[model samples]
Target chain A: AQSVTQPDIHITVSEGASLELRCNYSYGATPYLFWYVQSPGQGLQLLLKYFSGDTLVQGIKGFEAEFKRSQSSFNLRKPSVHWSDAAEYFCALNSGGGADGLTFGKGTHLIIQP
Target chain B: DTAVSQTPKYLVTQMGNDKSIKCEQNLGHDTMYWYKQDSKKFLKIMFSYNNKELIINETVPNRFSPKSPDKAHLNLHINSLELGDSAVYFCASSHRLDTQYFGPGTRLTVL
Candidate 1:
């Protein structure tokens, strides 16, 4: 079965520091990858997605993700993290179309230090 | 303007009682889905409807039923709620084979 894994359960970083959240997926074919961020008591917002072209995809809120096919990984990165960046991040995978449901990771909690 | 929205942001009910959560999307998408996020923040897809037809049901209990009156609306009804059923339920909509848009989510608590 297709699945997503986020190895780091919690990550603490200082403000203005660089950030990287790891995500790895298992699927038969080249998978459609997505990264979503959820703030406290808020719905998930799409940070970035990787489909076909360009291994590097940029998303809203100054976030970027690189899709590595051989490694079966899509890691989210952000430079100069802000205190408001403290939130939970989830990595999800889809098999291609809307017909298939997305397989989500357990999520990683990001803590921004002052 | 909310692209996808769910009613009753917070619901507290008894174990044996029944409750309903409504969802609507203004994006004119053909597909809608329900996902449950547990206390550990692990999200899993529960049900999906396409064009007002049930397309996917992921091992969900019979007590949980999803109804889609139209392409833009999907509702989830639970009969005999259980303590284990307490979780955050999110509603999402997407155009055919496109990125999905998620709602604010409804937190259901069974007492």
Candidate 2:
């Protein structure tokens, strides 16, 4: 079974500062990876996904993630985070089909400090 | 228009009561899924339907049943709900083996 691990439970970053959220996965083969964001009371919004071809996948809201095969990691990064970027971020992984669905991490709570 | 939507954004009920949460997707996708988010915000897949067929069913309690009327709608019904059943249920849709789009979620609170 494929599982995702997001080590950081909560991270606080000052506004306009660069941010990086670490995510690692355990899978037998090459996997599909994704990053999702959730607001205070809303549903999840897909930040980005890595299907194939590109090692670096760009997602919505100026977010990007690099898929490292050796590291088994797909860490989300942003050069400068705004105040609006404060939310819960989840890292997910899927081996193949959507039937089994994607396994998500415990989620990382992002706090934007002024 | 909402791409993927679920009914009763919040559901509050007591133990032993029965409730149903409806989900509909207008994205013309071929698959739909149900996921549960616990109080601690840990998410797990409950069930999945593809083209009106059960494609995935997790080790959930028998009280939870998923009914797919068509490819565009999947409804989740819980029988004799318990306290442990309380959580936020999310509905998602996706193309065949593609990125799944999620709904706003239904916060089912059992008191």
Candidate 3:
């Protein structure tokens, strides 16, 4: 079974500072990757997805992630984060089939410091 | 318009009681899924239906049953609910195997 591992349980970044959240996946083949953000008491919102492309994918809210096949990682990055970016971010994966559904990480709690 | 919606945003019930949470999606997607988010914010897929047929059923207990009356609707019914079953249940839909759109989620609190 495919699984996602987010090494960071919580990360704090100052406003206007760059942030990076590490995510690694264990899948046999090339997998579909996604990043989702959820605010307090809210549903998961898609940040971005990576199917097959240039490895670097940009998502909503000025967030981006790079899929490094050799590293088995798809880490989300933001050059400058705002206070509104403080939320729970999840890394997910799917093996490209309805049956596979999606395997999600435990999530990283992003805390923006002023 | 909400792409995916789940009814009873907050549910408070006692143990051993039966409850149901309804989910509907207007995206006309062919696949729908149920996921549970625990207190620690760990999300896991429980069930999935494709065109009203069960496509994926995870290692969930038998007390939790999913009913898909149509392609656009998938409802979850829990019988004899336990305290461990208290969590946020999310409904998601997608066109085949693409990115999924999630509902607002139903928070179930079992007393």
CA shift at A71, candidate 3, in angstroms? 0.3
The count of residue-pair clashes in candidate 2 stands at 0
Q: Comparing to the true complex, what docking class would candidate 1 get?
A: medium
Model 3: per-residue lDDT, tens digit, A21-47?
A: 999999999999999999999999999
**What is every candidate's C-alpha DockQ against the true complex, given to 2 decimals?**
0.75, 0.84, 0.81
- Model 2 agreement with the true structure over B1-111: per-residue lDDT tens digits: 999999999999999999999999999999999999999999999999988999888999999999999999999999999999999999999998788999999999999
Clashing residue pairs in candidate 3, if any?
none
User: Candidate 1, clashing residue pairs?
Assistant: none
Tens digits of per-residue lDDT for model 2 on A1-114? Answer: 789999999999999999999999999988888999999889999999998898999989999999999999999999999999999999998788546688999999999999
Highest DockQ model number:
2
- For residues B1-111, what per-residue lDDT tens digits would candidate 1 score against the true structure? 989999999999999999999999999999999999999999999998988888889999999999998999999999999999999999999887678899999999999
**Candidate 3 regions with alpha-carbon error over 4 angstroms:** none
* lDDT-best of 1 and 3: 3
Q: Any residue pairs clashing in model 2, and if so which?
A: none
DockQ of 3: 0.81
Over B8-82, each residue of candidate 3 has an lDDT whose tens digit, in order, gives: 999999999999999999999999999999999999999999878898888999999999999889999999999
